[model samples]
Target: MLAHRLACTDPPVNLLSRVQALMVDFFWDRMHWVPQSVLFLPKEEGGHGLVHLAGRGAAFRLRFVQRFLTGPADLVWRPVARALLEHCGGLGLAESLFLMDLKGLRLNNLSSFYGGLFNVWGLHRKERPECCGSLFWLLREPVVRVSRFVCGVGPSLQQRLCEERILTLGQVVEVCVGPVWTTLQAWPHV
Candidate 1:
């Protein structure tokens, strides 16, 4: 609302305050339960910051945010991609994969959940040798798995910790909501 007020009021200015307000709403508000530390700092500063696996339904939220946080989200993702690509330059695999951190995420907001997934998929797909294969399907594999556990949905108390390091906004979705997607797939992996 402050952004709208500043953007519309008086002389019609694009001041820093208004811009900042919009960015905050678009990014921070979207992520359901992340602290200020993850939201504000760059990935280099140590925060996965994406919304894949924070809670019961955060995957859905991250997925929504992944699609809609268009303007600023795109900008924020670019630098992270560049950094990842630069770091993985020597192996000569063309594409790089990152396993992000997922802790303290909320599940009520759809935008934050989906938004985080898109960021993860987008970042990994960058400069990859394979262009036609969208990272959406590739990342979906882990995300669907993690979401099941984090959401507390499809378990009778497993006696093991499955792929925990694969936690991210995407993996959270995998664990939390993997069951839902499995229904859609004829050969869904259990």
Candidate 2:
């Protein structure tokens, strides 16, 4: 809102000037070295580092399984997690914020560290011996955008949008776990 208001240059209420003043005040008077919102991880991970979702804009930066998440490893690294056994202890929003400034050393290995992140969704897929590993890193924005476009306004005909939706958001897009082709029910309300 501040950015938007400042961009509007109306009459005497010079939003740009007001924003410039605020920016000056923020930079000189209220500036801090680090953002307070960043949440720290346990000494086990590495730099008792932090991971915090800044705002809706920050949230949009998220992709893959990590996009919906907030806070640090402690909040998400749960032991009961379906795939990875290492993240038994889960962290949450407020509690994780307490360690914001601390920089400690994590004792765990890198594989154990991100178990909650990349491993969580594998539970639904059966291990296939014939399958090969993928070295490509995926961007989630396309998947999300495609899913929204297909599901938000397309025909429910399983033949059309259903497979597309599942491919985009995973089985969760259609509330089913089988092949994307199987779940394409005709749009119910229409």
Q: Return the top candidate by TM-score.
A: 1
Q: Model 1 Cα displacement at 123 (Å)?
A: 25
Where in model 1 is the C-alpha error above 4 Å? 1-74, 77-132, 135-137, 143-153, 156-163, 167-190
Q: lDDT per residue, candidate 2, 51-76, as tens digits?
A: 22222222232232342333455645
Number of backbone-clashing residue pairs for each candidate, in the order shown: 28, 13
lDDT of 1 at 147: 33
Residue 171 C-alpha lDDT in model 1 = 52
lDDT of each: 0.39, 0.32
> How well is each residue in 120-189 modelled by candidate 1, as lDDT tens digits?
4544323424443654544433332233225464433221223234323345455667744564475555
Query: Which candidate wins on lDDT?
Result: 1
Deviation from native of the Cα of residue 30 in model 2, angstroms: 22
Cα RMSD for candidates in order:
18.3, 19.1
